[model samples]
Target: MRFPFTALPLLALAACTTGPDYRGPETARPATPGAQFARASGDTGPQAPAAAAWWTALNDPVLDTLETRALAANPGVAAAEARMRQARASLRSERANALPSTNASALYVHATVPGLDLNDSGDSDQSGGGSESLNFYNLGFDASWEADLWGGKRRGVEAARAQLDAAQADVADAQVSLTAEIAQAYVHLRDRQQRIALARDALARQREMLRLTEQRHAQGTASALDVERQRHLAEQADAALPPLAAERDGYLNALATLAGEAPGALDGMLAAPSKAIVPLPPAQVAVGDPAELLKRRPDVRAAERRFAAATAKIGVAEAARFPSISFMGLIGIGGTSPGDLVDFDKLAAIAMPRLSWSFLDFGRNAARVGQAEGARDEAAAHYRQAVLDALRDGEDALSRFGNGRLSVASAARSKASADRTAALTRQRFEAGAATRIQLLDAERQSLSAAQSLSQATAAMTADYIALQKALGLGWR
Candidate 1:
């Protein structure tokens, strides 16, 4: 067979790609790379964040277990994982598009005709009606392949791979959010439980004061106003208990749902306070730098991947503006008799090479390319926004955590002062120097201070969880 000289240039240009290549997005960067976060205070250190499971740093066994369960069983995480699998399958399909596809077929036909003779000789001809039967059999293999002359199929595969990467990043993002939510709920639950316990203790003291006031009034020493006031204070304390209990239950149910269980499934395990106080985060948090934050944040990574995918799709669209080359082939063997089906002499083969171009679509392909470019621009903007958002999140979490630490410290000072005053009043009351009402009021102030401290600590822990999530430290 002689080679076709006219096909030389087409073969040479087959390796050429039509559209621009991806070199990573220019906008996917923090405003100040390698700079320490502006909102980080003395409480945070400029060190690379710890390993993926940052929750274990809190040193709470129950929290560690909850994180594990949420990551393993949460429906949101599972859904993200399923999407990743789907992207992978799509990538595989796109890769297969670059190769040829083949199919095999078989056919059989039988017919009978009247007034037709099955055998006829020139020496003998009959006018009488006769029936003739016929049978046909065929087997064939057909194959076709579209050549990637302008790299459209290759770009499609590239886009698919990028989409798979984005999907994987999405799964990681889900994990980050899940772990943070579980940790925050656990903190809130413990905080509410502690507050309830404190309120109950204060209520008992208030009731005792109320009883003492009533006795004093009956003895003609305390006024009726004093007794009523004591009762009102006791009632207020009692009323506070139900709301705290309700909030505690709400957090418990949230945690259970986060672990992929029913609302009350974790009640037995978490209803009671595990510790005397909510767990506090470490003193010095490792926040790394802005550059590292951008790299670690899954949302940023996912957005960048999507941008890359969009860029590849531009190439796919641009390739459509050019001609496409394809080839088809068929081979078969068949005969009238069953033995003839295997006969090489009855074999047939055909090869067809085709070129198709949509140059006269009145700028439809150009519009498609323009649309792809617009999409690419949108994805780039989204990626840039994602980067900025991640930076802001990290900074905001750091700021909240720093301020939370200050609030906790102030609350601690207030609690210490209240405790000292209460102790002095108790001493004075035992020595018969201070009134009973004075001592009870002192104790109430102390309890209020304790409640404030608990709330501040829980808020600080929540801020810590947010910081870790912003750092993308909850997934491998």
Candidate 2:
């Protein structure tokens, strides 16, 4: 009987595949707008920084170099990229299952029987022990295809595609995080350097005051006790420098490591005074609605994809419970002699359509479906949590940016007032009108104000960096 190839297409068209249709979960809608951290100032509509290279907006050449190096060398980012490639391969493999498969096989064999035949009958057949050579070769094609009578294969492919997309998002997320971390480290290192310089300056100024008090004592215009107090203040100021220097060194080491170098490797680059302020990108940070974040954030998207995969697995298990039908066929010629392999007498051809359904194992299929559903629920929960975190970080970063600017402003005024008060107190002491204790108090107040100003400046820089990270705008 000849089965025409054209019949296959007609059969496929006549068959109906069964399986659950996939529709993305509707839970992806955005969270409320009011009081959400993603909301920017004014309703001009939430704005993200330009999609092109967010780090470039800072306008720092050094930053550009560091970010480039980190993205290339960071282990976490590299691993994420590798995983994405694997996910894509998996998706492709799943999709390929939706089509028919053809396999070609060839076999060759030689054997000898030295004993009687091993069949049992009322009269046993016996043959004299003899050496005989048997050689046969067969070349055939076998094909098997499950009529996707249900959307099982299609659903599986859909789930895999979603997972592959999620993996790509994860890679993006890793890149975003790496850039933010590099920026944060660089800014902190610069601030430490500035603070170290400020501490040294304070020590020098105190030493000058001490020298002047000694001269007054020598001229009998100031008491010996006043000179001793001034000396003590100078010593206190000098003592603070070593600890600040130690902290500066610690930050330097950290920065070097982040740039993918051995500790102290980047000291040469940072040794020069880096007083040039790192530019802040934008005064305002915008967070689109939480719903938008689900689409934008890679981790959340990855979780959603995992959920979709698990949902499809449930249908896969359900399909396993139904009868599986497949078509198989082989055509070839075989003979004891190699030259006779193609003889008409030795030709053989077979075609089969097999249907298999397990009469037992009812509990196994049900258990598999249960497992898939449970996994899906877990993935959904993780996705929800990711959204909440993104919103929280965005809101928190904006608040810090605003409050940090205020802190720096107030600190500046305090430093200025303390400076003026110190100058006047010193003049009074030189005229012998102010007590030694009063002069000492003014010096301490001046030092305190200077430290406060340094702290505020560092805070302001850090807040801006944080705001950008929270808005998910710095990793483009």
User: Which pairs of residues have clashing backbones in candidate 2?
Assistant: 17-149, 17-150, 18-149, 18-150, 18-151, 30-291
> Which whole-number lDDT from 0 to 100 does residue 408 have in model 1?
92
Q: What would you estimate as the lDDT of candidate 1?
A: 0.89
Candidate 2, position 438, lDDT: 67
lDDT of each: 0.89, 0.71
lDDT of 1 at 7: 84
Deviation from native of the Cα of residue 230 in model 1, angstroms: 1.3
Q: How accurate locally is residue 247 in candidate 2, as Cα lDDT from 0 to 100?
A: 77
Q: Estimate the TM-score for candidate 2.
A: 0.81
What is candidate 2's lDDT per residue for 403-461, written digit by digit as tens? Answer: 77779889999999999998999999999999665676687678678778867876776
- Clashing pairs for model 1 are none
Q: Give the candidate number with the greatest lDDT.
A: 1
Write model 1 residue lDDT over 1-476, tens digit each, in one string.
99999988888878888778999987656567778999988778889986488888889898899999889999999999999999999999999999999999897887776776555542212455776677788888999999889989989999999999999999999999998999999999889988888888788889989988999999999999999999999999999999998898889889999999999998877757545569889878899998888788889999999999999999999999998889999999887667767888899999999999999999999999999999999999999889888888988888888888889999999999999999999999999999887898899889988999999999999999988998888887
For model 2, state the Cα shift of residue 315 in Å.
2.0
